[model samples]
Target: MHLLAHRGYHAKLPENTLTAFASAVEVGFEGIETDVRVSADNEPVLFHDRVAPNGVAVAALTRKQLSEVCGYTVPTLTEALDALPGIWWNIEIKTPAAASLALPILSDYDSSHRLLVTSFRHDVVLAAAEMLASDCGLLNAHRPAALSTLLHAALPHPNLRTLVWDCEIVDPDILRQANALGFRNAVYGAKTLYEHQLMQELGVHTLITDYPQYVGLLPG
Candidate 1:
């Protein structure tokens, strides 16, 4: 199983920052997952929330303004990739505008094997599959109406090979069905030892976890 550090191994550092990403690499994780949002000046920055704690929208601030407000540098998508090369990246486009802003930057890089762009918004994944050089995935938070139904709708796009489900919704049958349909099973929110054990037995392809160090020690 491939273990991806969620938010760049942020257990000890600020998430989506260069420091956090470097920390993930330092600890030897193969890949890191991060979120992308477009700032007011049209720069694609690494941030998770749509609104700041101060009730300001991330899109309403420039990259510099965001850094100042957050008290840390909000690295651009380009900056993050440039700073950490040769590591696999799971870039989650947080907004439709972010997909447009981030895809061009991703295209300029060597992305075919090293990048996977995903989103909860299926529309973003649909649009990205047409234009992106990297692989695309759909992130679902709950169990769909039917696993086959989801695969049938997604299989038309050849690049959409991964089904990122929340761990709460995963079961052996669902994982088995998804695998039979040629989809890679990836999940997040597997926090406990039992959950990790369950994921291992189910043979998940990827585990996007916040506690990479803890999960890395588990028998897979």
Candidate 2:
């Protein structure tokens, strides 16, 4: 399985920061997964939650104010894309506006970002696919939900590419079925060695985690 740093290497730095992403790159990760939302100015920015650390809505702040309060520059999607050149991305769209706002920015990239644009909101992911040569996927908290969603998405669109599953909830059957339907799958949030070992045994090709360092040290 290919290891994707979840929100970058946040064990030693803040999640989703450029510093974290750079650390992941330096550690030799093949992929990085991050979240995106549209700012008040209609620009796509990297942010995991709608609420900021100090209880302000992330949508309520401009990019400048966001940096000030957070004590670090939270990268815009444009910035994240530029910083993470040559790595595959599983960029999760946190809202519908982000799905729309991100497409134009992504189009300027050389590789369509080597991206699998994903979202918990089905409409948002579908909308992204409608807008570009989208390698898009639906995100679910578990494998069963993702399988159900895949059944829906696969029936209508052959372009659908991946399902981002919580590592705790994934199993061999889901991967088998996903392969049968012509989509790849990725898993996230595995924090233990056993989980990583299980994922490898199941033949997972992509995994997301907070500690890419330990996972990368495992038998490949």
Candidate 3:
């Protein structure tokens, strides 16, 4: 199983910062998982929430403005791609606007099969599917409504490759079915070594965690 650094070694560093991402790569994580939100100019910024410093919405600020506000030097998605290389990337589109914004930037790179784009909004995945060769994940799909949407994506879209799920609420049969339909699975929040080992035994492909070094697995 591969270990993904959740928001790039956020166990100690600021989430989604370039420093955090570089540290994860240095620690030999197989992949980096980061969030994307759009600025007023439609540039994709690496941040997890709509709200920025002083209650300003991330979408309302330009790149120059949002950079100094996100608690770290908030890099644009393109900047991140430039900074980190030779590893898989799980890029989560946090808003519908970002779904559109990220695709254009992603298309500029010959990203190979290393990019897995995801979002809570299935429309975002659908939007990505229309353009990129990258695999897509059905994000946060353990809830009832989201699971319904995930089931729909699995039926016809072979590129919808993973389900980013809450580990505790998973149904093995559902995962079996999803796998049967060509979807791999990745679980979030595996806090302990035992839990990580359990996922390894479960044959899970990826586990998103804060402490990749503590999981007792070799780097992929």
Best by TM-score: 1
User: Candidate 3: what lDDT?
Assistant: 0.79
Which TM-score value belongs to model 3? 0.88
Q: Taking the tens digit of each residue's C-alpha lDDT, what string does model 2 give over 1-220?
A: 8888889988879888889998888887888889998776766889898998889988988877787888888789988888767788878889877877776776676355687778899787777777657577878785565566456754566566777788877778888888787778778878788888888788776888887657656786
What is the lDDT ranking, best to worst? 1, 2, 3
Q: Estimate the TM-score of every prediction.
A: 0.94, 0.91, 0.88
Q: What is the per-residue lDDT of model 3 for residues 1-220, given as tens digits with 9 covering 90 to 100?
A: 8888888977788889889999898887888999999888878889887888769998888877887665567888988888876788889988877877788888776464378888889788877876777788777745563445557755566677788877787656666766776779888878777777777777778888887667556323
Clashes of 2: 0
Question: Model 1 lDDT vs. the true structure?
Answer: 0.86
Backbone Cα, N, C clashes tallied per candidate: 0, 0, 0
Which pairs, if any, clash in model 1?
none
The segments of candidate 3 whose C-alpha lies over 4 angstroms from its true place after superposition are: 110-113, 141-149, 217-220
